[model samples]
Target: MNHEFMDALNEIVESKGIDKDILIDTIEQALLTAYKKNFGQAQNVEVEFNRESGDIKVYSTRQVVDESDYYDSFLEIELTEARKIDPAYEIGDIIRNEVTPRDFGRIAAQTAKQVVVQRLREAEREIVYNEFIEKESELVDGEISRATPNVVYVDLGRIEGIMTRNEKIAGEIYKEGQRIKVYVVEVRKTSKGPQIIVSRSHPGLVKRLFELEVPEIEQGIVQIKSIAREAGSRTKMAVKSIDEKIDPIGACVGQKGIRVKHIVDELGDEKIDIIKYSDDPAEFISEALSPSKVVKVEVNEEEKSALVVVPDYQLSLAIGKDGQNARLAAKLTNWKIDIKSESQYEEELANGTLYAKEEKIEEEIVEDFEADEAVDLEEVAEFEAEFAENEEIEE
Candidate 1:
C-alpha cells in the first residue's frame, strides 16, 4: 500500500459509503492472516497500517523473561537479549520488532483487494435491502425482465423483483421488456440478496392507483374506506368525502371518467366500481352491489350478516356470474350477504322463516305507497291500511 492506494481507498469510501476506519481495520486483519499463511506461524504477530501514508507493516511481539524462565523462543525473549535491543528493558516487558517481509507489499495488495471486494458486495446488498424494505406495500414501476413457468422477474432499477403466479393478474399475458406497475407485497433478505415479492393482483394495487389518480384522496379530502377485488375481472371500492362539497365518487372518477379510465387501461380493462361509503351498514351494502339495483338490505348487526332483496330482474346481476359480485360486496362490507329476489323475500316473510326489521319493513311500505304511479293505487292503499291495522293490533 502507498499514498496512491490511499487516494483510491478514499474514492471507494466516498462512492460506496463505507467507513474508512473500518475498511482499514479489516484490511489490516486480512494482511495478518496472509502473513501467517505465507510466513512461519511460530511468530506472534500484529498488523498495523499508516492512515496518512497508506503503508502496511507487520510486527512480531515477544514477552521478556529471565533466561532461566524462558521456555519458548516464539513467545518469550531472554531478558539479556531484550536489554540488548533497549538497555532499559525490564523482565515481563513486551518487545516488538518489525518483521514486514521484503515483498510484503505485493501480498498486502492481494489481501486488501479481496477484503474490499467482499465488503463492497456486502454493503451493496445491505443498501438494496434497506432501500426496498421501506417500499413494501407501495407501488413501483418496472420492466418485465423474464418469465418462468411459475414466476415473472421484473427489473426494478437496482434489483429484480419476483412476481409469483398467484400475484399475477389472471388472463393477462406478460412479455419481456413490458413496462408495468406492480405492488410491493413484501421484502425479505436471503443469502443470495434481497428478495422482493411484487404483485399485480393485490387489492392494494387498486387503492394505490386511485390515490395516484385522485387528488382528493391524496389530499385527504376523500378517504377510501375499503376495497374488494377480483383481479382482471371486477373490483368494488367504497370511498367517503370529508368535505361535503367534494364528491368522493366524482373525484375518483375524474371529469369525463378520464382518471378511472387510465387506471382501467393500466389494469388491462378490469372493471372498477366507485361507490359512496355510508355509515349505515345496510346503505353501504346496497351501494356495494352496484349496477344491480338493491330493493332493501336487512342487516343482523350482531352477526355481521345481511339479507339483501333485489328486483326479480336484477337478481342475476346482483349475484353476478358465479356469485362474484355478491362475494366482492360481502368482502367490501365485511358482512356475509344472502341475496334474495323481492318475491323470495316476500315468501320468506310469509313463511316466517326470515325475520325482518320492523322499521325497515315500514320504510319499504311507505316508499311503495309514495310511488303510487308505479303501482295500482287501490292495492297500495289496501296494503298500507292492512299494515297499519296489523301494527295497531300488535301494540
Candidate 2:
C-alpha cells in the first residue's frame, strides 16, 4: 500500500463511516496470514503497518535466553548474540528482525485489495440493515423496478424491497417506474444482505396513509382504534376522539371529503369508511357495517357475538357482495355478527326460535301487568262513586 492507497482509505473511512483503525487492523491481519501461508508458519512473526507511508512490514521475533537455556534457535537467541545486536538486551527480552521478502509487496498489495473490498461490502450491508430495520411497520415511497409472476421488486433507493404476491392488492396493476407507497412489514438480515418485505395489502398501509393525510390523528386529537381492510375493495376504520369537541370521523373525513379523497386516490380508489368508535359493542358493530342502516343490535358479550337487524331493503347492502361489508365489520370489531333483515327477524320471532322465545316471555309479562292495572282502576272508580252518594245525602 502507498500514500495514494492511504488517500483512498481515507475516502472509504469518510464515506462508509468505518473506523480507519479497524480497517488497518483487518488489513494487517490479512497480510500476516498471507505471509505465513507463503513463507513458513513455524516462524514467530508479527505484521506492522506504517501509518505515514502505508508501508507494511513483517518482523521475525525471538526471545533472548542464556546459552544454557537456548534449545531452539528459531524461537530463542543466545544472550551473547542478542547482546552483540544490542548490549541492553536481557535474557527475557524480545528481539525483532525485519523479514519482509522482496516480492512480498506484490502479495501484500493483492491481499490488501481483497480484504478492503470485502470489508467495504460487509460494512455497507450492515449499514443498510440497520437503516431499514428501524423502518419496519412504517410507510415508505419507492419506484417499481420490476415484477415477476410471484414477486414485485420496488427500488427503495439504497436497497430493493420485495413484495410477494400475497402482499399485493388483488387485481392492481403495477407498471415499471411507477411511484407508489407501501408499508414495511418486515426487515430480515440474510447472507446476501437485508431483505425488506413490503406490502400494499396490509391494513397498516391504510392506517399510515390516514396518519399522513389527517392532522387530527397525528396530533393525538383523534385516535384510530382499529382498521379492517379488503385491500383493493374497501376498508373500515374505527376512530375515537380524546377531545369531545373533535369528531373523530369528521376529522378523518375532512371538510368537503378532501382528506379521504387523497387517500382513496392513493389506494387506487378503494372505498374507506371512517366510523366513530364506541365502547358499547352493539353500537360499534352497528357503526362498523356502514352504508347500511342497522335497525337494532343484540350482543352476547360472553360469546363475543352479535345479532344485527336491518331494514329488508338494506339486507343486501349490509351483507355486501359476497358478504364483504359484514365480513369487514366482524374483523374490525373482533366480533362474529349474524345480520338479519326485518322480515327475517319477524319470521324467526313468529317461529319462536332464536330471540323469539325471549320476546314472547316479555310480552306475557307486559300483559299480566296491564291486567292488574285495569282491575286497580275499576276498584278506585267504584270507591269514588260511593263517596259521591254519601256526600249527596249529607248535603
Candidate 3:
C-alpha cells in the first residue's frame, strides 16, 4: 500500500504537470487536518512526513514543572519524569514526546485520497485554462459529437466545447461526427468547469481560416483590407497584394480552385466575391458590384453615399436577390448606395427632373387638363353634329 501510494503520486505529478514538491506539501497539510480531527485538542502537536519513504511522525509538547506543582492537569508534568526523557530538561522546560494517533493509517489514507483528487482537479483546470487563453479569437479543429436543439457538442480531442445556436451561421448544417473548424469566441472558467464557447458564424473565423489556408495571407504578401459577410450566404472581401507581381485574387483562389474551394466547402457553399481593393471610392465600388457593369458611379464623399447606374437588364443582378448584394457592398464600403437603371437615370436627366420628382408632377397635371379638354370637345362636337343633322332633314 505504501509503494502503491508513492507510485500514484508520481503518476499524478507527471500527468497533471504539477510539481512533485507541491503535491507533497499538500498531502502533509491534509494529513495534519486528519490528525487534528482524530486526536484530542492537545497544545503544540506537530506533524512531519518523509516524501521519499512515505514515513510520518506525530508528537506533542508539554512544560516541565516541580513535583509540588505537578497535578492532574494536562500541562503540569513532573520534572523528574520529564528529565528522564530529556536529561537536560529543567523546571519550566518543554518536552516533546512521540505520540501515535489511533487509526492513523485509515484516516491518513482517506485524507491523502481526497488531497490527490483535489490537486489533480486543480491542475487539470489550470492546464485547460492556460491552453485556451492564448487561443482566444483563433480557430480550432473539432468534431461534432452530438447536436441538441440549442447547442452543438464538439469534441476537441481532450475536451468538449459547445457551439450555441446563436453562434451558428444561417443555412450552415452541422452533422454528427463531422470534422469542422470553429472560432474560439470565449474561454471562461466557471464553477462547473472551463466553458469554451465556439462559433461558425463569426467574421473573424472566415478571416483566420483564410490566413491558415492561403500562404499569401500568411506571409503578408496579400493584405485583407475589409471583409463583409452575411454568414452562410455571401461574403465580400477586399484584398490587395503588396507585390505587383502577385495577383491577390488568383493567389487566394489557388491552383485549380483548391484553396478557396476548401473554405467554401467548410462554409456550406457560401458565395465569396474577392475584389481588388482600390484607394478611390468610385473604382472600388465599381469593382465591388461586379458582373453588374456599372454605367456610372456618382459618389458624395462628404455624405459617403453613391448613386450607381447599371443597365436595365443588370439592375436585379447588381442589387442581388432581395438587395443582398447591394446591401453587403454598402456595408463593406461603409457607404449608403442607391442603384438605378441606366434608362431610368437618363430619362430623369433628359426631362430636367431630379429623381423622378418633376416628371411625376408634370404627368399628373397633363392628365387633368386632358380630361377637362376632352369633356369640352365632346359637348361641342355633339352640338355641331345635331345642327347639321337638323339642316339636312329640313332641306
lDDT of 1 by residue, 1-395 (tens): 88888898899999989999999899988899899999877458999999899888899899999989999988999999998899999998999888899999998998999999999998899999999999999999999999877999999999999999999999999999999999999999988889999999999999999999989999999999999999999999999999999989999999999999999999999999999999999999999999899998889999899989999999999999999999999999999999999998889789876665656788899998787676777887999999999999999
What are the per-model C-alpha RMSD values against the true structure? 14.7, 17.1, 19.5
Question: After aligning candidate 1 to the native by TM-score, how far in Å is the CA of 365 from where it should be?
Answer: 38
Q: What are the lDDT scores of the predictions, listed in order?
A: 0.93, 0.93, 0.86
Total residue pair clashes for candidate 1: 0
lDDT of 2 at 361: 92
Ten residues in sequence with the least summed lDDT for candidate 3: 351-360
Model 2: lDDT of residue 32: 94
Instruction: Kindly report which residue pairs in candidate 1 clash with one another.
Output: none
Candidate 2 structure quality by residue, lDDT tens digits, 1-395: 79998899889989999988989999999999999999979568999988778999999999999999989988999999999999999989999999899999999999999989999999999999999999999999999999888899999999999999999998899999999999999999999889999999999999999999999889988999999999899999999999999988899988999999999999889999989899999999999999899999999998799999999999999999999999999999999999999999988878778676557899999899887754777778999999999999999
Per-residue accuracy of model 3 over 1-395 as CA lDDT, tens digit each: 28778888888788778999888888888887778777866656767777876767777777889989887556667988887777988898877777866668777778888988988888888888889878899999999999877999999876788899889988677789999899999999987668899999888888998999999999999999888898889999889999999999999999999999999998989988888999999988988897678999999898798999999999999999999989888977888888999898988788776456646888989899877744677788999999999999999
Each model's total of backbone clashes? 0, 0, 0
| Candidate 1 Cα errors over 4 Å, as ranges | 40-43, 64-73, 77-81, 90-92, 355-395
Consecutive 10-residue window with the lowest summed lDDT within model 1: 351-360
By the lDDT metric, which is better: model 1 or model 3?
Answer: 1
